[model samples]
Target: MKTRIQELRKQHKLSQEELALAVGVTRQTITSLEVEKYTASLVLAYKIAKYFDLTIEDVFDFSELEEI
Candidate 1:
């Protein structure tokens, strides 16, 4: 899935480490997520959304992928 994580982080003036710390993940995790090499769990997603003061739908979208 593609995400606007980098853009959002820049908007907030946050480094990858800062975002990871805020969302309770490692810097590598944030890097992986930004590069689409990892997918976040629902709990992680919620934490990220909460940190950004956004709803999950606002931060993430899965419509481009088809169901299994």
Candidate 2:
């Protein structure tokens, strides 16, 4: 999934480690998410969106992917 994570993180002046710590993930996980190398779990996505005061759809773009 395409996400606005990197952009939002930068805008908020947050490092990947900080974001990961806030959301209870490893730095590598945040790195993976930022680079689109890994997809986040539903719970992780929700946590991230909530931390940013955004809905999941605002953080993750699912327009191109088929729905389950």
Candidate 3:
């Protein structure tokens, strides 16, 4: 999945470690999310989205999945 996490983090001046701490995940998990190496659980997605004051749709791209 494609996500705006990196962009949002940069815009918010949050490092991966900081974001991970805020969202209760590991820095490596943030890195994985940014790189698309792993998909987030619904809870994690919700936490991440909430952290940015955005809905999950705003943070994550579901267009490709919508085609299915």
Maximum-lDDT candidate: 3
lDDT of 2 at 49: 100
lDDT of each: 0.88, 0.96, 0.98
C-alpha TM-score for every candidate: 0.90, 0.94, 0.98
Q: What is the full ranking by lDDT, best candidate first? A: 3, 2, 1
Per-residue C-alpha lDDT of model 1 across residues 1-68, encoded as one tens digit per residue: 87778888999999999999998999999999899999889999899888999987788777676564
Off-target runs (Cα >4 Å) in candidate 3 are none
Superposed model 2: Cα runs more than 4 Å off: 66-68
Winner by TM-score: 3
* lDDT for predicted candidate 3 compared with the true structure: 0.98
Ranking by TM-score: 3, 2, 1
In candidate 3, list every pair of residues with a backbone clash.
none
